[model samples]
Target chain A: MTLHRIRGGPRLSVDNDRCERFGTCEWEAPGLFELGRDGRLRYRRRVSDEDAERAAAAARCCPMQAIVVRGVPG
Target chain B: MSDGDRIVIAGAGVAGLRAAERLRELGFDGELVLIGDEPRRPYHRPSVSKQLITGAARPVDMTLKSYTELDARWRLGTRATHLDTTQHVVHLPGGEELWYDGLVVATGVVPRHLPGSPRHDPRVRVLRTAEDAAAVRRALAASNKAAVVIGGGLIGCEFAASMRQMGRDVTLVGHARAPLYRFGPRIAASVTELHRQHRAGLAMNTAVRHWISTKETFGLHLTNNQLVVASCVVLAIGSVPAVDWLRGSGLTLDDGVLCEPTLFATGAEDVVVAGDVARWPNLRFDDEPRRVEHWLNAVESGRAAAENLLAGRGQARPFTPLPRAWSSLYEVRLQTIGLPALAEDTVRLADGVTGFVRAGELVGACGWDRPKAMLYWTAELDRRLPAPATTPAPARWSGPEARPAVGTAP
Candidate 1:
C-alpha cells in the first residue's frame, strides 16, 4: 500500500526492464536469487548496508544490467 | 543511420563474437569489422573439453553466431599481423589493411604448451579452439582406457569427465593442494571430493614435472617420482595470452596486455584490451589486474570494452569482473562466484560437500555424484544476505585451511 513495495528479502532485487538476466549474478551468488512462485527472480528483501558491493555484483552481472537493487543504506 | 559508433573487434573468439552480437543489440551503427586468426566463425570454447571430446557434441556446438546471421564484416580465416595506433589501422597476414575508429582486442587465450615439445604432436594435446577440438577428439577416441591429464584446472576436469564417460581410467594431476586453487580452496575441496566420489583418480599435490613421449604414448613423470603410463596426455595446465604477435606492438605487457582500470592498453585512445589478452583489475576481488580464461569473462570484457569505445574516455568505467565459471563433469555441475581469495572464514552449507559461503554470498560451490544441494545453494546466495557495503571475498574467503579428508575413492 506504499508508493512501491520491496517484497522480498533485502539481499538483492532486480528491475526486469533493466535486468537482461545474464544469470551471472545467480551463477556467482545464488543465495540471493531464487525462482519466485512465478518463476521470475526474487531477491532477498533486506540486504544490509554491508552487503552493498556483493549485492551490486549480483546486479551488475545481469547482462541486461536490469538489476536495480535499492535500500542498502547507500 | 541508427548510430552510436563503429566497433572494430579483433580476435573472433567467444569474447570477440559476443561483443559484436551485443554491439548490434546495443545499437551500434558504424562499420563493424571482426578480424581473427582462425578460418572459421567463432565457436564455443568450453565445449571443446566437455562435449567435443566425448563425441556427444560436434564442434558446431561452440558456434555463437552464423556467418549468415552476423551483420558485421567477417574476415574469415584471416590473421591480424600488426596494429598501428597512430593510424588506427590493423595490418593483416594477407597483406590487407583496415582503418578503424574504435578497436576492441578480444583475442582470446590459447592453451598453454609444453616448453620443449612440438606444439602439434600426435601424442600430446592442448584444447582451445575448434581445430584443437578435432585433435582432442581423435586422441580421446583412440584412448580406450587410460588418460593422464596434466593440470587439474577446469579444462582438465571437463576433459577427465569426457574420458571417464568413455570408461577410461583418468589420472588428474595438479601441483596444488587441491583442484582449482586458482578459484579458491573451498570450491577446490568440493571439486576434489566430487571427482573422488565419482571414481575419477584425483591426484592432488602432484605435478607433471616432465614427460617422455613416444609416437603412440606419453610417459608422464610426476614431481613425486611417480610414473604414469597413458597413450594420450591432455595438458589442461592453463592458458597463455594470445598476444605473441602483439610483441613490439607498443602495448605494455605485464603477463598480459596490462590495461588501465578503464580497459585501455597503450598507443591508441580508441583501442581497448579485452578478453584474455588484457589483464584488467577486478575491484571485486584483488585490485591487481587479472586475466581470466572463460567464456563469460571474454564476453563481459569485450562488451565493456566496446561500450567504453563508443562512450569515450570521459565516461568510461574500469573493467572489473565478477569471478564466475562453471564446469560439467559427468552428472555433476560445479559453478562458483566471487574471487574466493585465500579466506579466513568458510562455513560448509550442506553435508553433501555443497559449498562454503564467503561472507554469506556463494563465493565457491561444488558437489559430488550429485550437486543438487550445492546448485540450489549457489542460486540462493548469489548475493550475500544483508548485502554488505564491501564484499567479503578479500576478508572472509579462507584457504590453505583444514578441510576434512573427503574422498571415497581409493
Candidate 2:
C-alpha cells in the first residue's frame, strides 16, 4: 500500500488500481479531493486533525470504497 | 459440484457485476461465466450523465470495479443469441453454446429511440452508454451552436443543465408540462424553476416531430410546427428492456422477463432475472410487479438474486427492494425514495422540496440538497405499510409541519 502521508496528520492510502474517481470523496472533503483537468481524482495524502471528520466521511461514502484514512491525530 | 453446476450471468452492467461479486462472497466456487455485448467492463451509469458529461469524470473513472477484481470468465462484446431452457443451454453468435446449472439474466435496458430516427447522423446522440456520453462531450467541445435535447425526463434535464453550465444554449423538449411528471407539480415546478434559473429554454408539452440533419447543422421540428436549429441533438426519451435475445428461449416476457418475488423466472426453474430486465412483484409495494431502472435497484436486486440463486427456490425468500434514486440538477442533488408513481397528492417542504402522499401516507419524498431528510425518509419508507387499508379522505397536507419531528428537519 502506497501511503500518502500528510504533515502532522493522518496518513492516506488510495488504491489507485481500485479507485474509479467517482468523486464522492470530493463531495465529502473538498479540501482533500479535487478532480484534475484530465478527469482524475487528486487528493491530499494526509490531513490535519481538524479535517479528520471530513476525511472519514469521504472514506465512508466512496461507492468504490477505495479511500483509506489511517492514523488520525488527536 | 458437477460440471452442470456452473453459473452463467448475462449482461455485465451494475447488476450483473454485483451478482457475480455476491456469488463469490457467498463462497460459490462453481465456474462463473459473465457475458456482455459491450466491449468495455461494467461502468457506473449514474456518473455517465453527471460527471462524465460535465468533464469531471472520464470513461475510465466510471467503473464500478476494475475488470481484474472480478473473479469470473468474462466474455465481453459477446451477445447471447438464444436460450434453450429445456436443455439448460445458452446459444451465442458463431455457434457457441454455454450450459449452466444456474443462469442470471441482467440484460438491463436499451434507450428507446424515436421511430425513423437516424443512428448514422453525426450530430444526433443518445445518453444511455458511456460511448454516447463521450460522443456528446466531443460534439459539445467542437460545436459553437445551440444544443437541442429531446425528452425532458431525468436525463434530458440533467444534460440540459450540464450543457447550459458548459455555456451551450440548451432547449429542452418534453411531452409533459414538467420534466418529471411522476413527482407531481410542486417538485416538478422546482425543477422547472431550476432549469429556468440556469437559462434553459423550456419546450414543454411538445414532441419532436422530426429531425433535419444537414452537412453543417441539425434542425428539430416540434409538435407546434416550431423549428429549432442546433449544432447537435440528444435523445433522452426512455428505455425498453433488452429482451429480444430471449425471444425463442421460451421465457415469460411481458414488459420485461416476468419473475417471482424470489427473482426466479416464472417459466424456468433454474433461471433468475435482475436489474432493469426483471419485472417482479416487490413485496414491499403491493403485490403488483414492477421494473426499476435505477442504479441502486440494480445493485440491491442483483445481490438479492444471487443469494436466492444460491439458496434454491424452495428455501429462497422473496426480495423486497426499497425504491430510491438520486439526480443532480443545476446546483442541487435531488434524492428521492418510495413510490413516486403512487403519488396522488403533493406537499411542499421548505426550500422547494416536496413529498408525495397516497392513501393518507407519505409514499414518496424528494429534497433539494437535503441529505438528512432524504436518508431518514428512505429508511422509514423501507418499513412495511398497513396493507393499503381504506381510510377517510386524506387531510390536505400543509407540508412538514403536520408530521411529528423525529430524525431530521426537512
Best by lDDT: 2
**TM of each candidate vs. truth:** 0.72, 0.80
Task: Spell out the clash pairs found in candidate 2.
Answer: none
Worst-scoring 10-residue span by lDDT in model 1 chain B: B391-400
Candidate 2's residue-wise lDDT over B126-243, tens digit each?
A: 8888888889887777778888888878898889988887888999988898887767877778889888888999999898788788877778888878888888888888999999
lDDT of all predictions, in order shown? 0.64, 0.76
Listed in order, the DockQ scores are 0.04, 0.07
- Binned by DockQ into CAPRI classes (incorrect, acceptable, medium, high), candidate 1 is incorrect
Q: Count the backbone clashes (under 3 Å) in each candidate.
A: 42, 0
Stretches of candidate 2 off by over 4 Å are A1-74, B1-3, B66-69, B349-352, B384-410
